[model samples]
Target: MTDDLQSWIGRTRRVADEMATPLVRRMAALTDRSDVALDRGAVVPNHWLTMLFDDAQPQSQLGPDGHPSKGDFLPPVPLPRRMLGGRRLTYHAPVHVGDALERETAIAAITPKVGRSGAMIFVMLRHTITGPNGLLAVEEQDVAYLEAKRNAPAPPEKPAETPTAEWRDAWRPDPVVLFRFSALAFNGHRIHYDADYARDGEGYPALVVNGSVSTLFLFEALLRRNPGRQIASYEARTMQPVFCDRPAFLCADAPGADGARNLWVEKDDGAMAIRIKTRLT
Candidate 1:
């Protein structure tokens, strides 16, 4: 199975999309920044790039989990569940609204390993995004696939003490926000919006929050404190699942001498749900 999955390492695909004003407005609305400038030449938020180049799979092509059936572009991993593990992004130039963009994605690596939960397969995907001017950004996304559970809820983890931070902001994510985020990202994953499926099917206590949304909250918190600072690069890792309707705290440390900052999302119980490291230009 590993050999078969390894064959997908070099697979690549190219997709093109436009940064429309309406889309930018919707993204602004999602973040409660309805006053964001949406003019043609206005720069789109760096994290908002996830909303572009969506893979609109046909209804019939979707799997039981709501994602496009595997084996075409992605490898056919035998695991029964998948989730976002982490991402590293480097921005070279700002992507403005109305600019037509192209993205080239390739499978960079595939590794199978065993962890506390069980067997897992990790896939790394590399994306190079370009605009009419030149290269905009490059991203490496990590995706993990896991063995199916028997519908039994796993033991809960002990909560950790929250770390102190220079800046902190509280955010409550409800179903409405999760649904809007899923819509914006063109993600049809059932766990993000389906409470019943999340509890019964995935053993989650409630609807899971989108990892991308948590990352966005962290980034926005940083921006709130340091306005106008351009992000040169950032890396985010989802340490745990954050359920919808729960209040989470976005915390960030002051930039170090090197201009790099540390950020994280703290769950209500003080557990660190996500950790991020970012550098400013």
Candidate 2:
């Protein structure tokens, strides 16, 4: 594992740099996402780059039965376990088309944590991608996996949501959105696009969703629920596979003693999909 981690340190860096071009192209194709249109000649948007930061190199082979066997982090960073701690980003310069890039990598930290979820290993990885001219993007990603199954006790039920403002924005995700995000991240993993590949090849019942989108939705939920507050540091763990079209439920509670907002999300059956802690201002 030491040798594998060493190799991954450099490989993770490379993936960060190569991520921009595909990310820009793929994000520009999202016909219905936002008001900001990505001009082909222009550098990609902050959101697009944020999406790209999830890029990772293969660290190991899947087990004989096909799922990532225990201890395999091939497809490092966004591990199958859980992730948290991603926050504010500044787009220093537009990552333009054809910008050759490379990422500088470091194992920022690794330590043990104990919580209601039991023992866990927190791995912090820093990636800086530089382009033909200068720095394209810099991201410090904190990834963690509970050493044991993370089962959050059920929350006391709240009243049904009766909207003051009209319930707006499409809740369901479309195929195109998933495809565009997958392409942007340079993710060739079949679980996101090919339903059959997801079920038979990768062992998901349906086309599994992209984790980046979940991150975005979770962040947005934080903003909507806690207006005016700033997220200093944000972390989210992908606890289980989230597929396209599944309606999402997100929650962001007041900050804990660590000065970070506690946020979490899950898909239909309520498995822990993303566990997040956001630093507040």
Q: What's the true lDDT of residue 256 in model 1?
A: 85
- Give one digit per residue, the lDDT tens place, for model 1 in 29-110: 8887754689999987777888888778899989888888899899999997899999999999998989999999999999
Worst 10 residues of 1 by lDDT: 152-161
lDDT of each: 0.86, 0.53
Q: Per model, how many backbone clashes are there?
A: 0, 17
Runs in model 1 with CA error above 4 Å?
151-163
Which model scores highest in TM-score? 1
Task: Write down the TM-score of every candidate.
Answer: 0.95, 0.54
Positional deviation of 144 in candidate 1, in angstroms? Answer: 0.4
